[model samples]
Target: MRALTYHGAKDLRIDTVPDPVIEQPDDIVLRVTATAICGSDLHIYRGKIPMVDDGDVLGHEFMGVVEEVGAGVRDIRKGDRVVVPFTISCGECFFCRLQQYACCETTNDGRGAILNRKAITPPAALFGYSGLYGGVPGGQAELVRVPKANVGPLVVPGSLGDEQVLFLSDILPTGYQAALNAEVGEGSTVAIFGAGPVGMMAAACCRMLGAERILMVDQYRYRLDFAVQAYGVEEINFEECDDPAELIIERTGYRGVDASIEAVGFEAKGSVTETVLTAAKLEGSSGKALRQCIAATRRGGMVSVAGVYAGFIHAFMFGDAFDKGLTFRMGQTHVQRYMVELLQFIEDGRLVPDAIISHRMKLADAPRGYEIFEEKQEDCRKVVLTP
Candidate 1:
């Protein structure tokens, strides 16, 4: 089997590895069809995600066909097409019943803290991520071993395309979760900080939720243009104006938007020209757009931080949130909670997630796909790797 292994910062490769097998009665093996390169994966690529290690397979967003099922798995048979949720979960846990599958007790321990801890054994593990998590190996390979197959649902809807259903693994559900977090309503005004695939999807979901006006913020002109021409979203390039918040408020006639989405993850900061990456200061948050979001949002509005934030976050003003009575929602999106409905949305032709995928390549060319996405090449939104 060929799998992309993580070595170090900016180091990854597709190498032949032993094929995975169903280890437990509840486990199942999947033959990878299509997988996605996520913004969260970038954290590991940049060496910012400390848990990753040499020889660890790298990928989470994926959809595939079931190859083999363990004895305990009865709901899904071999050859069933399914979307793999990024978070491996056992659906019978207390948190899962509460619609919090990300914190499933049997698979993910102690509210996501267990995965981030440096010292956990095989009984508690995470796929693809290194030591910080469970290090169970990822899906960016020829085959993936699912720990809790029967409970995972392995959805098979006849109407949805594989490309469309694939995003349900992470970003689509995440975008839907972002809108839900922001409490986007009919005729509401919404602003999103990043214009990447997830951001664009958030914009699309906002539109579906009946937002009258949608404002997308990004430094890149191509992304801004895409938002406008493709989705009828309003674009705001932060570099063009001195005060983005003031401009957004002005555009909304001083009422400000009803909600804002933060889609940029660790890369959420000033432009490369402004970010001084010294040894002492590896990463620092100017948080200009987020601050602008707070300022641009209507009083009592909702601010959803869907962007990935690891380790420590700096320069966020707690006072501003307190003074404005802003409702702040932030976390790794609970994709399992929304996958069913989002799959229906895709089936209904209401969401076009596949349109955002601009690059497609084989597993052998996966590294090149990473480079293109990292460079943010013109109009590059989502990159897909086929195994």
Candidate 2:
């Protein structure tokens, strides 16, 4: 089988690899139908996260058809269409019960390896990543071995397509979680940083949650354009505005946004932007966006961060959050928790997540897809690779 492998920073390739098989009674082997690239995958491409390295298959957002199942996997069978959660949880763990599957003890952080097992050392172990998570092979291939499939839901709804349900694995649920964390409510005003795929999806969820006004911010014109044209959202070009927060406040008549969702993650800005401390903060535009989110948030409002972050940050001021009594909720989206609700939305025709998909290609062209998404070329929102 040909799989997309990560070979350090800004390097990737399509390589022939052994096909994945069901290794345990609870496991299942999936013939991947469609897989999408995620923003977290960019961390490995930039070599910022823990264990990214060459030869690691690096995709987590995927939907597929079951080719085989382990003996204990009764709910799912060969030929079932499914979407595997990015976080592979054992279902019986404490975190799984709490709907925090990302933190499950048996969860594999993109690496298919079960927790507590030993494998050859790699950069990170995320599905296609190399740092902290085990560098297990990912679904951006012809076939993938899913460690726990029974717990992972398969969408059998008659109305949904693979494109719409594919996002249920990661971004759709993630965006829903972001809106939930933001506490979007009836007539509430919300501001979301980064109009990327996740950010846009969050806006859609926010609208569904009854937010009266949704402020979508991004430096890129095309993305913000998509936000407004697709969802009837208000766009804010950070580049054009002298202060996004001030503009948002003006738009809301001096009451800042009721909630803010920071979807740019580590690209969030630092508390202070001095030359010496700039490098000490997060790597990308997220750091800058975080600063804007804090400034834009209304007093006592919530800030939900769903973007990826690594390690610590410099010049971070907890003082602002404390003074304003801001509620901060940020972490990996517990995708398993919201899968059902998101799928139902798809079934009801209220949400169409596939609108964010900008590019599609065969698994062999996975590297090119990564390049296009990384460079943000040609209004690329999400890239899907078919095996």
Candidate 3:
């Protein structure tokens, strides 16, 4: 079987690996039809994510046909096409019962003790993320073993192509959750940092939830322009502005936006001090985007983060957030909790996630795909690979 594997920083290769088999009663072996390189995958590609070893299969956004199913697996059967959620969860856990699938306690195998020691009980095990999140073999392959199969794989209608339904695995639901957490609604004003795929999806969802004004901030002119053309969002190129938060505040009549979202995560570009600190391991992540979010949000408003942050950050501006009475919401997406409803949104044509895909390549060409995406070459927004 051919699958994408991580060799080291900026090194990804399509390797022929052993095929997967059902390893648990509830497991299913899927023949991957389509898979995508997520922005999060870039974390691993850059060696920023700990515990990703050489040859670890890498990818989470994937959908495929059930080639085989374990005896205990029900609801999904052979030949059924399904989109597997990136967050693997046991539906019987306490958090799962609360519909917080990302917090499922039984799937992580307790290997996240490093993170657990930091008072953060690691959440769900994710496909191909890292040892910190359960070093499960991921789906960027010809075949993948999907655990918690009955709970995670959502069966989609044959009428929908893999491209249309693939993002149910991660970014779509993530953006939706970000919007929900930000309390976006009719006539709401929102500012989103980062014009990447997740940011664009957040803008689409905010618009759907009836936000009247959406401001998208990014350093990339192409990405910002795409957001404006696709979602009718107001674009602010931070590279051109002295201070994006100040610009946002001025645009909103000095009240700031009703809510702000940070979609760029730990690797966000920041000041020279922050960059040096992050590179030297003095800070866990750059707090630049979050700072902008806090500064651009109105008093008593919400600051929602869909971005991934791993460890402690230097000078996080907690005092500012406190003084403004801001509400903060962030975490991994409980993908199972929202997949069905978001699928309906896709079916109804209310969300067009695939519209953001700027490149498509064969699975064999994934190394090139990763290069272009990581480097932002050829105006890349999203890349979908077919196996």
Candidate 4:
């Protein structure tokens, strides 16, 4: 099988590897049809996440057909079209019962190593993610072994295209969760930092949930402009303003935005030197976007973070957030919990997830796809690869 593997910083290759076979009674082997690179994947690509090893398969956002199933996998079978959640979870756990699939206790085998390094318990195992989670082989290959088959793979009707249901694996629920965490509703004013795909979805979701006004902030004019045009949200290029928080203040008539979303994680627009230093293991990740989120959010506003940050963020304004009584919500999305409702949103003609896709290529061209996506070249917002 051909799949993209991580070699090092800024290096990925489509390598031929062994085909997958069923490993557990509840397991399924999926013939992956479509897979997409995620913004979080850049953390591994940049060597900032320290979770992957050389030759680890790279990819988490994908959908496929069930090629085979284990003996205990009764609800799933061969030829079933499904979108597998990136977070591999056993549905019978206590956390799973609470709809907290990301924190499932039984899924991750990498928690010891993760806690040894970070001093915090790890989340559920993630496909194609680094050893810091589970070192599970990702879905960006010809076939993948899927665990917890009964719980994680959400079956989609055959009529819906892969593009429509694929984002439901992660970013769709992530964006919707961001909005829900912010507690945005009718007549609420919101500001979002980072105009990437998750930010775009957050904007769209905010409007769908009845936000009265939406403001998008980003350093790139192209992204800001893209979000503005796509969602009818006001845009601000941070480079254009002396202080972006003041723009939020002025835009919301001095009250600040009612809520804010942090969609730029480790790749946040901060000092290039510091980001490089951090990536090189010289310092910590910068909290440039989080600072901006706190600065732009109104007093008592909710700050919802959908971005991926692994370690301590330097210069985080905890005091400011505390002083302002701001509510902060941050975590990986519990994807399966939100999939059904969000899938309905798409099936009802409310969302076109593929709008974020700017490039599509064969799985053999995955290396190039990663390059374009990581470099943000060719106005690329998203990249989808077919295997």
Question: Of the candidates shown, which would achieve the greatest TM-score relative to the real structure?
Answer: 3
lDDT tens digits by residue: candidate 3, 320-343: 999999999999999998999999
Between candidates 3 and 4, name the one with more favorable lDDT.
3
Off by over 4 Å in 1: 109-126, 271-286
**Candidate 4 lDDT, tens digit per residue, 1-387?**
988999999888989899988888999999999999898888788777666888899899999999999999978879999999899888888889999999887888786223235555567899998887889999889999999998999899877999988999888899999999999899999988888888988988998899999988887777777887788898888888767878898878888999999988866667776677676766456788888889889898999989887555677879999988999998888998999998899999887777888899999998888889877799989999999
Which lDDT values do the candidates have, in the order given?
Answer: 0.80, 0.79, 0.92, 0.86
Model 4 — which ten-residue stretch has the worst lDDT? Answer: 112-121
Write one digit per residue (lDDT tens) for candidate 1, span 1-387: 999988888878999999998899998899999998987788788887665668889998887888998999878888889987877777776777877776665774322332355653222235676665567789899898988876564566756667978988888988889999999989989999899888988988999999999998888898888889877888888778777788889999887899989998656666454266422365443465677778888889999988876443455667887788899998766777898888778878899889887888898888888878888875677889998
Evaluate model 3: give its lDDT.
0.92
Clash count (model 4, backbone only): 0
RMSD of every prediction: 3.1, 4.1, 1.2, 1.9
Q: What TM-score would you give candidate 1 relative to the actual structure?
A: 0.92
Pairs of residues at least 3 apart in sequence or in different chains that clash in candidate 3: none
* 1-387: candidate 2 lDDT, tens digit per residue: 988887778888888988887788988888899998898788677776655566778888887888988999979878889888886666787777887777666645444322444763222223544545655578888888887777775656646678989998888888999999999989989999888888989999999999999998888899988889888889999779768888998998897899999888775533455324536543233356666778788889999988875544554557877887899997776777888877888888899899888998888888888889989987898898888
In model 3, what is the error at residue 28, expressed in angstroms? 0.4
